[model samples]
Structures are given as structure tokens and as C-alpha cells.
Target: MTEEPVPVTRAVDFGTAKLLPDVDRARAWLLTVDDAPQSYVDLDDPEHLEFEYTRRIAHVLESAFDTPVHAVHLGGGALTLPRRLALTRPGSRQWVVEADRGLAALVAEHLPLSDPDITVHTTDARAWLAAAPDASADVIVADVFHGSRVPAHLTSVEFLREAVRVLRPGGVYVANIADGAPFAFLGSQLGTVRAGFGQSADLCLLAEPGVLRGRRFGNAVLAAARRPLPLDALARSCAGDAFPARVVTGTALAALTRAPVHDATATASPVPPDGAFTVG
Candidate 1:
């Protein structure tokens, strides 16, 4: 496949593997999920490399936690965020949980994550979070996905509770999710996330309400912290420039009051009462 004449936008090699992209200038990406390899089309514009999103993530996280952070990935991609974190904060320790065995095997083939303060583990994200001890992680990134869908179990209410359970004090949870126009899953996800993290649920949508209402294309980063998240500082620190495309949060934060928490043990949860969040 390496000899097939695919454009190589960037390439590298890690301690145990060769890092390369299947194509450059736009191609396809097969993400390994809990089940199998799912496909996505890369517009091939440097603009769409999840790196843009990852960069913003790096910026917010670095500013949020001044020192190097102990990070955990519920899903692993080209390991872009982990790699960038390693470069920006040397000596950080990261654990990436990837479900696809073949995809895990191909890490060194397409990208190298091991050397960059990351340990790749093959497993389901929820199970890992559930079985782990109390407050074991400082920050948990639940960006697990294959194509546009998340594994069925991963989105369930029970799963998110465990995600929150494994986070340490002031630990934050970040999840990358996709939804259809009209944001078919947005409300319910907000509902479920509210149930999981109480008033700490904060959203960073790749698209805005009008766009999400159209539901044609959507991707968002939903973040929750054991403590209050710094949405305003993040907004200010962004220097009034949106990441990737135009995005504004000052108004949205008003509409995103924290939903009430369902019992941590319950599978299906109900949205909690108002006043759960201290609206910004």
C-alpha cells in the first residue's frame, strides 16, 4: 500500500513502528471502534485535519491545567491529540484505550503513539472505566468513535456515570460526539450527560445551534469537570477567535443549564431539576 502513490502530507517513525498516512490531499480514514473499522472522508484540506480541533483542545487544556496533566483516552485516533500533548508538554503520561485490535496493530503502521508518553491498550472504553479504581484519572477524553456512530453501549447513561466515577477531584471529562441535523441526539445526550456530571456539563460544538438545528453535519466536544469548568476564561483566552470555524459559546452557555443527575446506578436516567448549574 505504501507504494501505491498516495500523497504523503507528513510521515514519521516511532520507536516500534512506522508512521504514515494512507493518503494526503484528501482520502479516507478507517477508524477502529469497539466493533470494526469505520470509514470517513477527509476533505484533504489541512483545515479539516482533526488536528485543528485537537489544537484548540491542547490550548484549553494546557491553560486549564498549567502543569503537565495525566491524560487518558477513551478512544484513540491517529493519536493526534496525544502526540501534540507530548510535543507541547514533555514527560506527560497518557493512556489510550482503542477497541479495534487490527487498528491497534496498525498504530505503528500509520502512526506512532507509544513513544509520545502514550500507552495503547486494546479494550472497550466503558469497561475500562468501570473496572478501574475510584478517581484514577486526572482527565478522561472519551472521543471514541468509528465513522459517525459511537458503539451502542458507549452512549448509554450507565456508561457515562462510570466515566465520571473514574475521574479525580477537579478532573475533567471530554467527549467528542457526532449528531444528525436537528441535533437528533443532542438534547438526549445533553440530558444523559447532565445526569452523569451534574452541573459541570459544558459543550463545545463544532457547529452552532442554527447549524446543528439543520442537523446536516455536526461534531462537538462535550466537557464535564468534577469542579466547575472555566468556560469564560476559555472563551476569553481564545482571543475572540473560533477554532476550526466560527463558534460562539457566551450565549449557548445560558441555554445549557445543568440537567439533574439520575442515580449513578441507574441505566436510563431522567433529567434533573433546574438550579443544578450555576449559569455563567
Candidate 2:
């Protein structure tokens, strides 16, 4: 038998980045920054989403529209979701903003993206969003993270406004937020997103039942749009996942309360408990 490929490790801008191969899936790689799991991509199968949060994001988009879309990704970790979108929605145009140039280059060298429609930029996500043309993207995905926590500036009302500004009418804004019981950060983020969308939008939170019920620390996906969301279809799609998730809306959603975060007061999300997102 041939020797297994060793993990590729590099010192990226933010931290040490590693691409560990999946023994079961030859072309699959798991990316980690400072020991925190960041992204997993199966080169041979772009449709395969190893992370639950990614699947939830896909559920929101798939349930919302069946046609090609103009998508902006705030975080580009291995370009996993972008690759999936390219396959699922052919002819789709995508822009990915990743802050770490070294990490982006590492991904490019190891896991090159073949789609001519997708472009990758090395810059701050919030800054890129501010400069993006009005109504340019049909979907904006906010999955940026600094190590295991979300950066403060990207969690503010101003950033949310920029995200909304970059989206086309009725477009969706989806973010992968992590929080546990007494979800102060999560609550504040939901409030900030709602405030950004104003009174005309439909907002929903998706997460595993345990996570919602305060049983554990995990990722929660926030999806908001100006138009009515396909809640019924989204609910069905989420419930059918390998790790079934629940969608929160209406009064249950309203019960989660926190002040909208402004740039001055914004803080990075709370640090995860040990091994909360670590992958061996």
C-alpha cells in the first residue's frame, strides 16, 4: 500500500493552520486554525457538508431559491460552501472574503477552486462588505471566526447594515454563530441582525435541539431576509438532517432578547469550552 500523505501545516496570519487528510475520503481535508476546527472539504464531492452548521446554511439557501444566485461569503475557510454552491447552483457567481492571505494561499495551493465564477479576496470581511456594490449579492454568508470566537467588529449593527446593503432585494443573510446556555452573545447577535433588517424581514434561528435547549455548546445558524421565509420547507429540511435541528421563530424567537450591538460596544463571541470545537 502507498504511504498516507502527511498533514500540511503552515503559520498563517492568524495562527497555525493545518490541513489534515481524511483517510476514508481520499480527497477530503479538514482545516484547523490553532487547533480549532475551521472547515472540512471533500474535493471529490463538493455537495458533501461535514459540518452541521454548513448544512443549515445550505438548507436556508436551498429552501429559499432553486435558481442560480449571486452569493458573497464573508469567511472563506477551505472554500467549502462556495464549492458546494458552485455545484448545486451552476452559473452562480460567488465572492469570498478571507482575512488571512497565507491561509487563503494554503487553501489555493492544496485545494484549488476550478470554478471561474468564484473569486477569492484577502481582506477584512467588514471592510469588503462596506465597499461592495448595493444590491449586488443574493446571499451573504457570515461565517468568519478568529480562532474559535467571532470577531467583535463583524458582530455589530454597522456590519449587519453593510451585509444588508450588499444583498439584493429579498436576499438572505445567513451566519454561523456559536453559543451555549444563557446565550448572551447569541441573543445579542440575533437582535443585531433583526435590527439591521428592520421591520420588514423574517428572521429565524436554527440549531440542534440540545443546543437550543441549553443542553450543550454548539453552533446556531441565524437566517434573515426581507421577504417571507419558506419556514415550512426550511423546517422540514432542517428536521431531516443527520443531526436533526429545530427552527425558532414567532414568539419563541421573540423570547430571546438582547440589545443590538453597535461597533463601540461589540465584543467577540464568548470563548468555547475546552474541546468544544477541537478535532483530533
- List the global CA lDDT of all models: 0.56, 0.93
Worst 10 residues of 2 by lDDT: 250-259
Q: Write the per-residue lDDT of candidate 2 for residues 1-280, one digit (tens) a residue.
A: 9778679999999999999999899889999999999999999999999999999999998889899999999999999999999988889999999999999999999998889999999999998988889999999999999889899999999999998888899899999999999999999998999999996799999999999999899999999999999999989999899999999998898888588999999999999998799877
Q: Highest TM-score: give the candidate number.
A: 2
- The top-ranked prediction according to lDDT is 2
Question: How high is each candidate's TM-score?
Answer: 0.69, 0.98
List model 1 lDDT by residue over 1-280, tens digit each: 3445232222211112222334544343433332223222242332233433454455457656766778888877566666666656667788988776655666545443347468888888877777888887788887765433565677666777888788878887776655544443555666667677765455443333434455344455666665656766665544443443333443663354333333342222222123221111
Stretches off by above 4 angstroms in model 2 are 1-3
